[model samples]
Target: MIRRILISCGIAFVTLVANAAPDDSIKVVKGQVSDYYITVTHERIVKGRVLDKNHQPLEGATVMFFASPMHSTTARDGSFAIKGADNDIHLYVYYPGKKIVNKILALDENNLDIVMEDEAHKATAVRRPAQATRWYDPQAPLSRTFCNPVNISYNFEPFNNNVRPNGSFRSSADPMAVEYKGEYFLFSTNQGGFHYSKNLVDWEFVPASFQRKPTDDDQCAPAAYVSGDTLFYTGSTYEGLAVWYSTHPKTGRFKRAIEKNVLPSWDPCLFLDDDGRLYLYYGSSNEYPLKAVELDRNDFYPVSKIHDVMMLRPEEHGWERFGMNNDDEVTLRPFTEGAYMTKHNGKYYFQYGAPGTEFKVYADGVYVSDSPLGPFTYQKHNPMSYKPGGYVQGSGHGGTFCDVKGNYWHVSTCMLSLKYKFERRIGLYPVAFDGDGVMYSSSAFGDYPNWAEPMDIKKPADRFTGWMLLSYQKPVEVSSIDSIYTAANLTDESMRTYWAARSGNPGEWAQVDLGAVKTVRAIQLNFYDHKATQHNRAMDIYHQYRVYASEDGKSWTLVVDKSDSDKDCPHDYIELSEPLRTRYLKYENVHMPTGHVAMSGFRVFGNGDGDAPQTVKGLTVKRDKKDRRSAFISWQPDTDAYGYNIYYGIAPDKMYNAITVLGQTEYDFRGLDADTEYYFTIEALNENGRSPLCKTLKY
Candidate 1:
């Protein structure tokens, strides 16, 4: 039956058979179809209209209909409908906001009209999801499905402030992002203070007085090298492959001269040879093979004495070991850590991050060479294509920068989930090069682009590389505010449907416009948690969140909270304090304001008065079991509805419930004991009744 339904839909069974007749004015039958067929099918009804490079019609445009048994999808107007007996087909059209269409169908036809063209949203500009804005029509006929591997969106800075890699410091690969002049430093080794970005989606934290720690405790090999005023680094200490020197290379201040095992075999890299010598590649990985020394053109150090070179592994070349057969256990068993070498134009690529490290369909690889050390050559289409969120499972220690207009970039670091503990994160991709220099990784970059590289307003100090002009950030004036602060009206959608009608919410809370400040400090609540919200608050509202600082926006102050209340909040951030100077600020709503409150955007650096915002009402709790120690609460008649609260606790207690739970979900008490501890809380009832108090959980 069509090769047993393409082997039970894992698809991929090519064998098309030929036929003549059934043709009554439509001919397109080109053979190949076996594996016991006898079903008399007669498919072929493709239609299409996925457009953007100005062609129009692209409503969810995702059509696919590869032939060889079958595979289909295409609706929302870009219609499709395959049946399959075999008449010829091969159409894969995916329009993730535009662009991605491959066709070559020849099925006797009924009415075909495909036209898809979105060349990467015309170079990056497609950020739509407020229900996708509408409009689709440029002559329709679209329908087909089964092909989606293009949802790529770039602009990364997913925080990997490492140092949390535990037990003898397990492992945390490299991240090395650099933009120098205009800002974007990122350097990684899992974490050691250093994340500054001017706009790669806002990143901050360069404290530890700008960190460069040369010892006093070392691990370092998250590599950083600056060139021009010299600032090269390497780390793996007890004092070993150490190497640190900074004539203020971008100014983080360094000076740890150990020179002796310059490559104590870690992740150091520093090439700058065009006759000036300074090659230092290191590696105890990529199956141990990457070594080089040569340095010293006046204190670049290590003048030669490292050796090793070559051995990035994998490639007996012959069906590259046939998919190497993944009976599927997610498969992964080949190694080779990060190896870096780049040379553009004179050609010498050689990137790495391969085989094992939590396999995601065999990780990254690239190779080519003219000489950085020798004999590179892989890339007959090496393992380059498997990026489930570029940061999935310990990506390899990667590095490659080039942006003075030579435009080549690649910074890797993966592990946002690889099952085996340690959630490593950090990603940035976009490296093209193929004229034999080999390097291709374009996860769709047709629009909405910005990974830094476009701020040379006539050399604004070359974007201030290694930055050092720090001055402009002072401006917080909301009409000399003394404080009348009520705040919390968030552009009202009935107060976000009244806090999304509570229960496990995702709505309500609006009072933002903090565009003038003098001293209100922190407040960032761009919250969102409704993947099935409903656990009664405080698991740190789905793991972690706390950044409350208010000067009258309604009595509050918790300032940048994160005593690790469990862990799992991440959605990017910027809640500040220690540098206040505000006009007013508000965004108090620590995790899960109820259950599923969604807010995709909200900024308030200080200053308000945009008016309207001050309602706050959502509480309804009920529980009655009086005597085990307490229980007997009643509620359910909210005038303008806002009166009823209760929260209980006990079980790995940190402190769960303490009064503040009125208008009944039932609550009464008197030391009983089978277990002993218990907790519950709630409060908010007004228009002349109950207020003040809120808590939830206990069992």
Candidate 2:
């Protein structure tokens, strides 16, 4: 007789067949069998091939499992075999400059073939449906609005071999934007080139360097000026460096204007006056005052002796004190550099960056004079450009210029200083002169989304888009995490902290759950360089990723697809073509240039479903008796608010200066004129919106 029995061994089911054996040793206890064999099955290998649109084999393409760590690269014949779980699996195929292909198949399946299309060519060929709500349009004109930390491809440090032997982070500081022949040209320090744009929205990099002299160093804090049809450029150096000029800067063609500069200066500014005269203003030291000298319009040589213009008086101006918050005075002295001169209404406004570039308090102050070289007097409303608090900080070491619409704008350096002390970015703000001729750049929501083109500037907050942040302190989830770099860092509202995945491989992702279904309009992905290896500018380096949205976390719909993007965007901001009403947003990593998949901020902005925070109460302002230039401002904290914006000025209508303090209820306002009686007010802000402005109080 033959008999068969099924027995449970622990959690496994096993079958036993016996031929009428008299002695069968099978011990069973509590439905568990002792004699049993557990057969383990290994993962199966999935094979695939990647081909181009023309059926040509594409090599070096990456094939990765969506939720598994197993991955493979295509061989010369475009064939790949990756091991994965025996069940159904999701796979992603990625090739540079080609459209990404995603597939869902069983691991037992074989001979998977994916045909990729050219991303650039396909983008141009695809057209949006006439009646559809479009989220993005490559061919359509961009909106007039823009945000701070201008979105350009910031290059890695090219010549810092001594301090950065392995590699440094993306940085560009000391910016100068000038309009030349109806186009705007941007020049900054250590970029290895410059960028030009027809409208400031889109910038095209032009690789060109100055003709260096024997005694000069590379460009650090460059200066550019447009005279007639030619745009002149030079760098900061104690030893004279040659000046270059270019009529067609878009072509990256430049010729030496002067073989060697006549005067040796650092942080130089080449200013061309309305009267056909030229002057150079330069200074970059804590001890020395800014100096100016007339340059001959003919040969670009000094025509007059250098004269001292202005110096830093930390004792008098509280904003000039050196430290992270202008609170240090025992050891460090403030350094004043970046001398920029703007002539308006027959009055010369000399602007300079102060304190320190690495500090959040880094700002630009103005001094007024009747002549280019002055016995200058400090402006009553000083620090013409100040941005002490925001997502990106600092507004120092920059130049100001007028746009095509005759609207004044200031382009300045923003602080990053994470990888290295000089690691930074650039920002642009709308500037205006009051009826009294006092010049001030509107920086009140400085880093928030604002109109990129000219708009009504009657009020300081007129340029703000009113899109409140929706990702602050939100819940987040991730595919993988490091020991320390957890997912919580994503919504901390800080650039210094980041969420770093365990690997840089494809399929790693982070998902954020906005507390409720919010009307999402924009997303800003700020990538952090964690364990990056590249030391210099790499033109081919880029990031590829995909974003998805869903009301429920399980069912996701594609929103932003950049899997084939060729451009490098360290701080990538995307404004959706149509608003997405979803509670969850997911970011899937396709490729990283040099490091692990790390992100400092996965910021989401739009309207909330709830009400704005209530107006703050118990507002108080105490002017320092010993130092009238500084004041202590505080208010009762709101339970629903995440931060406060303190607005103050000499008059209630003129509350032009605003300090954004996040996660705080108090601020030490120090950038004040001693004799000015200021009016102060505070506004509460949260993910929903900003509260109504509190009652103004005179101090």
Candidate 3:
């Protein structure tokens, strides 16, 4: 049987006051009986005074009524009055210096008095999933001092600050740092070379034991595993994997034991089993498939036994993917890269990097299995993090480690300096597990249990305030409907609009000449694929169409009604119709409506005379001398019309026979061959109508 238990704040205080005079008796008014009511009641004359921690009355305290729809504010005397009805009500009292009070009460007595205290918990101390972690010392003075600068795109950036006096190479990603005997040693890999560090942070260049080998200088990512005095590291030298062993790790020199050239791999990591066998698990990228090989404790090479772990394949999961086939264009499709394994509480946590380990998809996730080699289950609430704008892009290369306190932490590289576009900085975050032992990234030091913050509701007009257009989905042509329109509202103007006209023909841009209107501030183009329209797909699923406006119709500005949108865009058309105003507004364009096409419902708003425009006639058309099949044409725009139009014909006598009207000043006709003669002419159209044809010339 499944049961849902509700936890309630059990603290309550009741206050009732009785005055001597009859006139002072509590006044109760029977308000209009309705389904909804506020916490404060009229007849009860619920008046109250609130004080702060020091017992001083707080001015401008916001007393909120939850579950109910009504609330009132404290006046100069820290007093408020409310007309409430009997209901399950929770009062949330808030002020600048006082702690927030959430009180649940059933109305009985008339008079109410309350006092609030200073909250010990500060707002800034609130832990978030993206911020929770031991590495993030919220109270630490040096919390924001460091920066992350690493490019996870190529998936290879060395860590550790181990530096040499010559300053040959940089290494701040020191994951395999251990102190043997009296000296400390660090291991790092970037691109295809190896580096080491005496200290954990500072790093120095070292001769790569596998670099000088007789190959084309291509090396795969590396992972180091140290047990007792024997140091083991995996290296990919051009072909397959080559395991290197070294006793003099401090000297950074190693000797190869066995090189297996079969499976394609990178970022090879070594793990030891209870039976004393070594397991090699590595992959191409966090998005690629990961393979595993069993190494004999005797030789550290493949003992003729191999295993492959299917952690993740981009196509299997619903997340974004990248890297394409044949061509070099990067897609949102998945390509696995970083793969690390950790054992905790009898469970093996297999982590994989995905999408963009930074900028776009700046988070990491983990899978768990009871046995180290069995099938694993992926965490549901993954993306494990929400990284806002920061230097923490591609932050998923380092491994997870346990601190001295037995707490878990994750250290990875964050691309801090994009200057190289390839190098990145290393950073650390804390990892916490739920009751089920699922690894998750934390934005704070502790796990948040059953806590959810209320989202603030915003008005439509209020939403577009101070908005700016930083970028568009793609560059657009004047014809295709899918264009992006954006705006920046600096003046805070509430209402602005533009006008449009429905072309008599469907699926056409009906020209609306804003007659004599010089400047246009705002515009709106009505897209009616509604029930009355013919288009069904657009009407059924809802897509956007194109609508543009201009200062001078001749130099028109493009506006898209709906182009860029996630499946769950917070603001949709339903919200727009609910009384919204804005200074700058653009119609985002989308594909043509599915079932219906629009030809009517043209509208115009803003400060302008909505009327017909004048037409211009004088224009010229000429065929290209090089390729007679091509034609070049120019036309004079009408001053009153704010734009012009043009047409052409293949026969000289039928100059205006075949016409293709254009908006801009020039038009280029393609697909013509050399030494061919073509005849063309021009005409101007506006709100008034199409004008007479002008000069026609042949090449």
Best by lDDT: 2
Tell me the TM-score of each prediction against the true structure: 0.25, 0.79, 0.36
What are the per-residue Cα lDDT tens digits for candidate 3 across 58-89? 67888767766567888888888766655535
Q: What residue runs in model 3 are displaced by over 4 Å at the alpha carbon? A: 1-186, 191-209, 213-219, 259-263, 285-288, 303-306, 311-320, 323-332, 356-362, 384-388, 403-407, 416-421, 443-699
Question: What's model 1's overall lDDT?
Answer: 0.41
What ranking emerges by lDDT with the best candidate at the front?
2, 3, 1
Instruction: Give the per-residue lDDT digits (tens) of candidate 2, residues 131-240.
Output: 22255543352456666678788876654443354354677899998988877889998776888777676677887755354222247899989888888888987777
User: Higher-TM-score candidate among 1 and 2?
Assistant: 2
Which lDDT tens digits does candidate 1 get at residues 362-429?
Answer: 34566776877666666554344223221122234567776565565566654432212333444454
Superposed on all Cα atoms, model 3 deviates from the true structure by an RMSD in Å of 29.0
Q: State residue 127's C-alpha deviation in candidate 2, in Å.
A: 18
